[model samples]
Target: MTCMQLLLYSYPYVTRFDLRRLMGQKIKLTKSTIDKLPIPQMGARVDYFDTDCKGFGIRVSSNSRRFFVLKRVKGKLTRVMLKPYGVITPEQARVEANKAISKLYDGIDINAEKAKDNLKGMTLADALKKYFETKTLKPRTVENYGDLFRLYLDDWLHKPISGITKEMVATRHLNISNQNRKAAANNVMRTLRAVYNFANELHDDTLPPNPVKRLSNTGQWNKIERRQTVIPAKQLPQVFQAIQKLENPVIRDYILLLLFTGARRREMACLRWESVDLEAKIFTLMVTKNGKPLILPMSNFIYDIFNKRKALRENDYVFPGHGKTEHLIDSRKQVNAITQITAVEFTLHDLRRTFASNISGTVVGGYELKRLLNHSFGNDDVTAGYVIHSIEKLRIIMQEATDHLLMLCTAGKKINE
Candidate 1:
């Protein structure tokens, strides 16, 4: 038997010193000693300890040799790699080993200390960049977050996230609210809260509690009511007449489609020809705000609009634009023009509200209305889960609603004539 094997057999409970001696010769680990050490066989390693410094050693393996420091940390022996043999001289390794041993004796966790340092150094901008990298947010949501930071938190970008205090958050919220941008203030705080919470979770909870929580605790958050604006049914004809006179055919059709389908502006604006079915008399939205695809039966008016757009199709988009997206974006100028001419003040979303308000009780049931709007039933509405409204049924309801709207428009046109 080999001498090392016999020694292992004799001493069942071998100490690290005994193991080190069995593995390699005990010597002062100078550059000369490290260079003279024999490399172990393939798949084997030999650890040579320095007699001059306790727990300082050089590990020789088939591949390479590296310097390391060994210490008992929290009752467990831990070996921390310092540098490869050629990367640092023997004197440099000794200096690093001494520092490492000192830290271990002081009960300082090197890894934990580094993590804390990183957390402390992270700025709001850095946190935001990391948040975007780690999250799977929709493009529009990402863009909106960027816009919020630029508009509201631009000054705070370079500020360390850990340094932001509860008092600072409260003061900022109050100041933004006083500027009459109550909704913007709430949105900014919410965005900051999301980013801070994400960072706190990411850094092993080493960060302080989110400062944005201060707004809620101190009742400093703005109380902005949801807008309930919608076009009065009587004014539908005026709005329609003004929309028809729009010079830009694309914008004119886009606004009409929004009113006809009760679709969000972006949803209708970004429609593709592939999603529209001329024969089926239906249109489908593959990407809706709720993340669910919507297939809605087109009313006669909506079908006609799509047919007209099909004839004028210049690209894949139903309403093609000259921009990078190759789809219609905003039509605020045209909408504002209609509002001015008809004296009917309304936003694009207001048309969506108008469509729902006009047709809710008269044309469809509660669940049917919700389905038409592509809204989630939510967990609270258990009965809604059981209720399934088919496309044909929805088509009938849509037709009835479209007929009513057309009747109003016709009446308004006759009055104007």
Candidate 2:
């Protein structure tokens, strides 16, 4: 019988010995022997091992022949492809196979090493995006983080996180502090630290140690005192008068509501009409910074403001704006205008502080004050855990505080006049 006809006829019943003899027993794979290896059936592949190199072999499929190495790595058998037969010479494939086998014996996981290399090359911007995707962050917090990066670390956004050294972070912190932005410098570094920490944990600690720790290590961090400024009770009338002069009624009422209710800037900014119940004399903040729904009773003064806004309602937001969010995002310009007019400098947060400071210990008990502020109870506050303040009960305390505040404003107006 012809050689080709005999090989095809005996293919189905061929033993390893018979197959080896058919290929001339030259198992030490050379170009000539590899070229003579028979292709398997259309749907199958045949593995031919090299006698000279233990674990080095060639896979002959119906369509192609590829070089491969099989070895046990970390106690698990693993196969790694070198290159196609035509892409490299048999000698080159054997060299690469030996190198791979050495690495495997040394307990180096090649796949994991490649993954670590890829993560090490991740840019700061990409890492931040991955962090945002993996964590549930508030929109305001996300915006704040974006602002911190843009304002301080814009130059480093495209650079790989690994390239950011401790010296660089320390120098940047000093430069920002020299700009009279000590608080901003601290915030930017804090944000960077969070992003780096997230990346390390996400990538199986592939990244270097967090560079921001240098600030704490060398006392390079800025010591910013917490702002305790509040609108003095005597300045209430002047502040109210300045707010009333604002051309934008939306902004004026927004500031007034913040002062009276002590709601956070974002919570009050994103207030919806559906969340306000004028008839029920209450308002609900469906989404709060603390991730808790806040149901607050509207004081008479706050009720009047909501009533006026209802007649002039322009959209879903209580304080509508022309911005993309369809709600008031920032009232800084108007607040700055008021600050200029009255010379009573304050921030939006200061308004909340003013509300709390005025009525905290006197107008409401400590438990009631905590409830009014929607503050989470600490683990050590055993009394707070037992006390439950209902909205109806809080309405009385809120009205009393509002009355006290209005009296102060009226007394100030009389003195001014």
Candidate 3:
């Protein structure tokens, strides 16, 4: 008998084996061959990272690591890896594997994906967020824009951009006018036009056209009555004397710079030390209402103020706040205090208007004035329209205006003995 025949009679698990028979001769079995045969045993349990299974399985070992794999009743294979001896207990692995197997039996796949549907709409709030991201506006400007949006357009923020019509915009104008008749309607119209254009760009051809183009208004409702806070042009000397009387060096220099340069209140208030170029004698307008970078050559008066500021400059801000890192954010209260004590009724903002008005009468034209004051230049339909203005002409006009202010300041000064 062959080795298979000998083992088959003794072994219970052996079922069948094929062997060639010699012609009319019986095959002989080797005892050593039959004794050397080994058989596989029943399946073992698996425990890995809270994984547990029971079936005909595999015991896998790699680099001192051990794991188990088994076929489930659903004709799918599952793996239960034994946690490293110390890092995680085999008991934890067994628990996790049992949970996974239960989920598999229930036909729930955690990795399965379901289709989702989302709505699309261009809204005022969405437009505002985009504006904040792309627009290079001054900090105060950004703050003011947020304020206007909150105070005036909070309800409209949720309204779809496409739904806003020219009629609605006109109605908003009338509404704002009734509340503050003296408000600058031109500014409101301009802001609205800009916002619509912004929304149009963002909508990417979805918005048919800018609706503000269809709207028309004379912008007469925005007329603001000018406040007479400045001393008469002839009495500029008295104003200079009043400024010099202020004891605080920061306040004194700030006031002098304002009067000399004719920069807006917040421009002076928020001016950083880096923005000032002592060598070039220019203050670069990186942030302005008009959103343009302007280089303003310093006048002698402004240069002197810068000299004084440099001597006392302890912080990065030209006008340092008390125990704060940035410049003095609000000088309105201080300006108000000075006006009250001096019996002057004009606000700090009025000073800017005064500067523009006072300089307009001289050789300074509209464009030069706009560049200096950072005012927006309008086209054919707007007042204070300026075009094709260059900095060279502005430099000359600014230098003359500053010199005039400086002469006024020094005329009444006491001679040091």
lDDT of each: 0.85, 0.86, 0.60
Cα shift from native, residue 283, model 1 (Å): 1.9
| Selected candidate, larger lDDT, 2 vs 3 | 2
Q: After superposing candidate 1 on the true structure, give the runs of residues whose Cα lies further than 4 Å from its correct spot.
A: 1-90, 101-108, 412-417
TM-score of every model? 0.79, 0.75, 0.53
lDDT value, residue 237 of candidate 2: 84
Candidates in descending lDDT order: 2, 1, 3
With candidate 1 superimposed using the best TM-score fit, by how many Å does residue 39's alpha carbon deviate from the native?
Answer: 17
CA RMSD per model (angstroms): 7.5, 8.2, 17.5
- Sort by TM-score, best first: what order? 1, 2, 3
Error of 1 at 380 (Å): 2.6
Model 1: worst 10 consecutive residues (lDDT sum): 3-12
Against the true structure, candidate 3 has what lDDT? Answer: 0.60
Best by TM-score: 1
- lDDT by residue (1-417, candidate 1, tens digit) is 665664454444776476556665668988887887765556566677889999999887778899998888889888878889899998999999999999999888876676677878899999999999999998999999999998988899999888889988888888888899999889989999999998898778878888998887778877878899998878887888888889998999898888877899888877899998899998888769988989999988888888889999989999999999999987889988987898988899998998898888987788988998899888998899899888999999999988877777767344347
lDDT of 2 by residue, 126-221 (tens): 999998898898887899999999999999999998889999999999999999999999999999999999888867976779999999999988
lDDT of 3 by residue, 1-417 (tens): 654454443343645542112111221112232123233222322112211244312232222333332435466564444344334444554454466556656765422311101113767777777788899876767777777777667778898877878777777767877876436444555665677788776555557576666545434345566555665565555565666777777877887777767777666777787888898777876656566766788766677778889999978788888755367665566666666665565656666766766777674776677668777665663554525555565667778886555554456354121
